[model samples]
Target: MEIIAEFGSSLLIVGCVLGFFMAWGIGSNDVANAMGTSVGAKALTLTGAILVACVFEFAGAYLAGGEVTETIRKGIIDPSLLASTPHYLVYGMLASLLAAGIWLLVASIFGWPVSTTHSIVGAIVGFSAVCIGSESVNWGKVGSIASSWVVSPVLAG
Candidate 1:
């Protein structure tokens, strides 16, 4: 069926895309941000930060990232579910990434402190709302995730 094929293709394409994003996002957001503070403090030169960032990032991701991949759901959604999923989901996701990227670039250019992790999650939710109607979204998931930001401040404090 043409519908079935379309659904399959969309699911696979999006999954692969999201997988690539996960890896890059981890290296870019997690590793780079971690060392950004040191660079800001002038303890490490930009080149030094980048080189060490490359090494430690690769080591951490290649070594421990497997644990993270293990926790991801490969194909929890059935093809039937896929068929019901709107094509706009893909568009929304792309837009979300675009927003986050633009935000991060602008913030970095202006030397404003912002959180990439927060931006990504916000992008996803923003796009999710565009794809599925806001009424269809599970607020519980959003709420729980928001709790992470709240908890982080308490944890840091």
Candidate 2:
């Protein structure tokens, strides 16, 4: 219970809380997407839809979510910099995650649907700007990523 007294355990607890919220959000959103057809066609009743969604969503979060987690691997930053000051890098990464999690949590609480990708990207930019200065951050990659907002839908449609 002494989260403040113990840094490692505090992080574990924080991670668990964040993980729960993240899983819940991902599941609920995906459930709507996956079951929309079934619900529309009346193939699955409302209760059936809810039950199937809750069960499969929990299973998917616990199993499939662990399949590929390279997104949190921090390969975006140079390895040499991490080695030089491990705590800074770790703190930065943790802070970025927490910031994004907080943003998502607040958004969900207020019933405002937002993209998790955008939340994470904003967090990364915040941390990168703080740690490496604005100049050190690559604007080109950021521009391209931002540009995709308009490009993807325009091309697909």
Candidate 3:
């Protein structure tokens, strides 16, 4: 649509803001989850954990985020399906980001410890299903992700 074209640049800004919000939510939740045990065991002080997370999150993203980012961007949903209407994909991604951020906020407020990965994945699935159709989604990948979510805590324990 003409509107999308006209405001394409603005959409980038919006995307960045949404991405920041989502990342913030994820970082807060994940760092707490990661450092909880250490703090509980008195192995690390709360301040130390916070400091470590601040440094390590940036380091981790800078050092190891690329492959995972690429895989998520390319493999999660077949973007080729929206080749002609790429704006839909943009809209869907934005919706997913916002959805995930809101989900994280609500979960935090309710004292329900939830995985940020699960929130984002569920948002992506819902957005893709509604925007593109269920056929466009790779359920096998989703299944794998779900299994990992279940397996991770057990493995950690």
lDDT of 3 by residue, 1-157 (tens): 5547898789989999999999988876788788888999999999998998889988988998997677567667788998888888888989999999999888877767788888888888888889989988888888887898899879999
Worst 10 residues of 2 by lDDT: 70-79
> What is every candidate's alpha-carbon RMSD to the true fold?
5.0, 5.1, 2.0
For 1-157, candidate 2 gives per-residue lDDT tens digits of 2323457776777667766666566545546667778999999998999999888867765886664244334423443444655566656767767777777667766766676667766777777677877654556766766787779879999
CA lDDT scores, all candidates in order: 0.61, 0.66, 0.85
> Quick one: best lDDT, which candidate?
3
Number of the top candidate by TM-score? 3
lDDT of 1 by residue, 1-157 (tens): 4434667777667656765655455555555667888899999998998889888878876998775334211111112233455455545545666677767766665666677657766776665555554654556655765787799889999
lDDT of 1: 0.61
For candidate 1, what is the TM-score? Answer: 0.60
What ranking of all candidate models by TM-score puts the best one first?
Answer: 3, 2, 1
In model 1, the runs with Cα more than 4 Å from the true position are 1-33, 40-42, 59-82
How do all models score by TM-score?
A: 0.60, 0.61, 0.89
